[model samples]
Target: MSIPTQPTDPAATIPAVGRINWRAARAMLISEGRLLARNPGVVLWTVVLPVAAAIILGSIPAVRRPSAGLGGLSFFQLYQPILVFFAITLLAMQALPDVLTRYREMGVLKRLRTTPVSPTLLLFAQLTLILSVAIVCMALMVVIPPLGGAPWPRNPGGFVITYLLGAWAMLGLGMVIASLFHNAKVAAGFGSFLFFVMQFFAGLWWQRPNMPVWLRDISDYTPSGAAVQGLTDSSIGHWPRALHLIVLAVWGAATSRLAIRFFSWE
Candidate 1:
């Protein structure tokens, strides 16, 4: 066979800068964000459901009426952040698994594999979407409750730190679940079970002090329990929010490493 001459155009001979790895990463982030934003179920779970839960929970006659020791802060105020945590927990648990599995099933992951970007970049992009949405939800939870008669965080710094730690913990837990589950559906079911278990035993619907001493102590060690305690303490003096933050950070780091290590592209 006769050899053919090379193309004269450098553009045809070499890949453009736009085709580089960083560029591919940016594109992946944008694509992943758009896709997550477009998912109706995700939209409902992340945005609408939390607000709905807060509203419904706050409407209960007992919750609307304040009792002793419970800050005049309505149930909405107390529950809003918890609801935000719930939303983050739900979204984080299912988002990665669902997106990864769907893309793998659709050949998207296979095509992405041929690109300059690593599969890890795509996964991070999805995580970024979930976390970004979570921050927005936190903002809404913080802002709306104050408008509805909830007291502002007396120690805004503590509130911010504690909430962020809680968010990280929730994200870590979700990533762990996603890593374990092969499909979005399984992750979703598992997430629901985890949420109910955590919320019920923690202080989501009521006060932890009401529980037995042993249960209270155990609950204090849980991420959800720490979050509620840290948040509640924001109204009075800043308590040892450090413990919650530390526990959450440790869990987050460990689980995040495991998630990355066990993450599957197939």
Candidate 2:
């Protein structure tokens, strides 16, 4: 007797299992982008708050006064970098981690693993959205400073380099946090705590130039602190100090490697 063979499904054969599914990835990216656009918290943190803070600070007469310590730049001019750093911190620490952990909690990443489209594509989409928001916020920051008569960066190229490096370091740290935390609530809480501490070191609450020598020394090593210092240096026409760039590069490389190694699909 001959054995009966099961028929293969033509639909299944059309989408090869091991191939990259750009169509699926693109669809997922569009969906995630729409969700992100509708998130009130993301809008508040990444867009509205940064711009509002810059405008408010720029409006202050005292802050507009040129400071001898700031290389004759006004307090508002010096604050431009801090506001940009704040936007980066908000997205990288608070927003990115929360989203990734939520996906894990919802089993979204696990489900995606069964398809030809890798779950990593979703992560890339989210990062792209966050980076776009950050760029807009940074541009707003640069524009607002000039509105208050604050001078633009003297070394624009150096400023761009510092900004990109700082963003890479912070985003890498966020990825690490997301990879480690399974619970969305815990991830968000920890991210917020990190955000505040980094902002403190970045001099959002106090002027870096006025900080005690030891404290300033310590802050310079922190990612946010290094970013602020690098941006400030570049704003005045100097290349960021080798030390600051090194710190940022080290953090970016180390945290990114750790995140990739530890990341879980579910």
> lDDT tens digits, residues 1-266, model 1?
98898788867766654454777679888987777657657556556777666655644556655555554555544665567667676666565556666665576767767865667777778778877887777676666655655555678788778777877777777777767776667777887788777786556766665667888788777878777777767744465467767776776788788877876666
Q: Which candidate comes out best when scored by lDDT?
A: 2
216 in model 1: Cα distance from truth in Å? 1.9
Clashes of 2: 0
TM-score of 2: 0.88
Cα displacement (angstroms), candidate 1, residue 206, comes to 4.6
lDDT of 2: 0.87
> How good is model 1 by TM-score?
0.80
Best by TM-score: 2
Note the residue pairs that clash in candidate 1: none
Worst 10 residues of 2 by lDDT: 9-18
Candidate 2, residues 89-140, lDDT tens digits: the string is 8899988999999999999999998876789999999888888888888888
Report clash pairs, candidate 2.
Answer: none
